[model samples]
Target: MKFKIEFSGHENIRSNHQKTIEITKESHLTPQGDCIVGVNANHACADLPQDLKEKLKNPDSKITFSIDVGEHNFTIEGKGHPDLILTHDEDIVIRKSDFVCPRTLAVKCDKASDLLPREMVSMLQDPKTKGTFTITVD
Candidate 1:
C-alpha cells in the first residue's frame, strides 16, 4: 500500500522550523504500511537572528499542526519537545493513533536543545508527547 504525509500550521511557525522525520511498519502483512514525514527550517532560515533560532530549538517548544492522510485527519498540538538530548539529525518517533495504523514515526528538531528547557525533556519523551486529538475519522 502507499501513504502520504501532510502538515498544516501557523505560517510563521511552519516556515521557520526544522523537522527530521521517519516512519516504519509495525505489521508484517503490510510491507508498505508505513510512511515518513521530515521537515526542517534550520539551514533554510539561517538568516534569522540568533534569538529567533534559540526559540525554535527548545525541546519543549511546540508547533501546532495537523497531519492528514486519506480520509483521516489527526490534529497535533504542542509538538517538537523530546526528553532525550536528540542530536542534530536524530529522529523523534511519533506514536500511532486510530487514524493511522500501528507504525513508528519519528521527528527531529534541528538545534532544538538551544530552545528546549532542561526540565521539559522528561515530559516530552513519553510516547504521546503531543496532546493530539483526532479531528476526523480514526
Candidate 2:
C-alpha cells in the first residue's frame, strides 16, 4: 500500500509551502500492525507555544489534528511527542520508546523553542491557530 500524509495549519501557522509525506506500507508498517510516520520536527515542533511544548513533554500528552483522505475526513490524536532528537553531527535518533520503529520519517529540528514565529505565536495566543494533516492509505 501507499500512504500520503499532508500537514496543514491556520494560515499563519501553516507551513510556508505545501507539506506532504509519502511512505510505503512495506517499509513503514510492522508485522504487528504498527505504523510509523516520520514528521518534520522543524515544521511541527520548533514553533509550538510554550504551554504546548510543556504539555508535549509529558508521556501522556495528546494533540488533536484533522485529516482528510479522499472522501473521508477525520481527526488523528497523537500520543506524546515524537522521539526524534538531533545530534551535533546532524543525525537524528529516537530518544524515547513512544515510536517502536527502525527508521524515522524525517529529520529532527535543531531544537524546539518555546517562542514560535511571530505569526504563529500570535495565532496561538489568540486561539485562532488550528490545522490538520491528512493521511491516505492505499
Candidate 3:
C-alpha cells in the first residue's frame, strides 16, 4: 500500500535533528523544530488512509518513506511495529529509534533529518518550495 503527502517548505527548516524527520500540518515553523523538514502538510498521522495505517502497525511490514523537493530526492527504509497507534492529528514522524508514538509512521529508520542532503535541506528552507512525501509498504 502507499500514501502520499504534499507539503511546503518553511524558512525555519533546519533539518538538524539526529534521530527523526517530521512533516507537520501546521503552517509555521520555529527554529526549535530542527527535525521538521516540511510544513503546511496535506496529511498528518490521523489523516492517512485506513489500510495504509493498518500495514504500518504490523511489525513484519517493510516501509519506505521518501521525500522529493525540487530536483532532489531522498529515501528512508524502515519497518512497521505493532506498537504504532497512528493517531496524532498534526504530524507524521519517521524515527531511527524503535520507540513508537502516535505521530510515528515508521521505526528503526535508516535515516533522519541530520542525514538529509545539505543541498536538499537548503532547498527545503525556502517557503515557496513544494515537496512530496511518500510512504510505501511491502
- Top candidate, metric lDDT: 3
11-122: candidate 1 lDDT, tens digit per residue: 1121112232232121111212122232221211223244433443444555433443334333443333223222323223333221221121222323222232322323
The lDDT ranking, best first, is 3, 2, 1
Taking the tens digit of each residue's C-alpha lDDT, what string does model 3 give over 41-74? 9999999888998898899998998899988999
Clashes of each: 17, 1, 0
lDDT of 3 at 29: 91
- CA lDDT, every prediction? 0.27, 0.29, 0.93
Assess the local accuracy of residue 74 in candidate 2 as a C-alpha lDDT between 0 and 100: 41
lDDT of 1: 0.27
Give the TM-scores of the predictions, in the order they appear.
0.25, 0.30, 0.98
lDDT tens per residue, model 2, 1-138: 122333322222221211222122121222232121222222323333445444544445444433342343443333344443212221122211244232322322221212123343234222232323432111
Per-model RMSD to reference? 16.4, 15.8, 0.7
What TM-score does candidate 3 get on C-alpha atoms? 0.98
lDDT of 2 at 23: 20
TM-score of 1: 0.25
Q: Model 3 lDDT vs. the true structure?
A: 0.93
